[model samples]
Target: MLLPQPRESIQDNQKGKVFFVALFTVCFFIMHYGIFVFVQTSMFFAVSSIYRGDLFNLSIPALK
Candidate 1:
């Protein structure tokens, strides 16, 4: 009976560790994806503004 108790406790500890590791991995992936999307959107807007000639006047003034 006592032998079974230690085995059960060890299994529970392992399960808990696995659960936390998986949770952290999922959160990390979500955060990385969010940052990637934000950067892509910002770059798209910057490129579009430049393409529309909106940034030309701004650049000329900066060069002066």
Candidate 2:
């Protein structure tokens, strides 16, 4: 504890913490999206078959 404290209000402290948390969250999600795309596009580690999963599969034929 110092004898003379620099000026800082509670709101200022809260705002700083909030800003840091938001920045961290944004970075985290960006990294998450990048890794997700890499895995889905570049890897076959997924055991559940893409066809069996009943979602999107480019191999299936499309009707005109």
Candidate 3:
């Protein structure tokens, strides 16, 4: 029936969105961790702040 086709298409769209979201989330976390590990804390915080819209960049290099 036409009703079933629409329902299936809707489900497919939802699944596609969910998959992309999860993939992006995983990539985001991985990239963040990699940056923190490879770069200085101050630089990392500044970049992270930009992405997070934080009030200010907390550059604490000594913490490293």
Number of the top lDDT candidate: 1
Ranking by TM-score: 1, 2, 3
Candidate order by decreasing lDDT? 1, 3, 2
Per-residue CA lDDT of model 1 for 1-64, tens digit only, reads: 5343344456765888767988999999999999999888668867665343343344433344
- The clash count of every prediction, one per candidate, is 0, 0, 0
Q: lDDT per residue, candidate 3, 1-64, as tens digits?
A: 4343344455765888767988999999999998877567556666755344343653444554
Q: Quick one: best TM-score, which candidate?
A: 1
Candidate 3: residue 1 Cα off by (Å) = 33
- What TM-score, over all chains together, does every model reach? 0.60, 0.49, 0.43
Q: Residue 24's C-alpha lDDT in candidate 1?
A: 100
Which is better, 2 or 3, measured by lDDT?
3
Quote the lDDT for 45 in model 2. Answer: 28
Residue ranges of candidate 3 with Cα displaced over 4 Å: 1-10, 40-64
Which stretch of 10 consecutive residues in model 2 shows the poorest summed lDDT?
Answer: 45-54
Give the Å error, residue 39, model 1.
Answer: 0.3
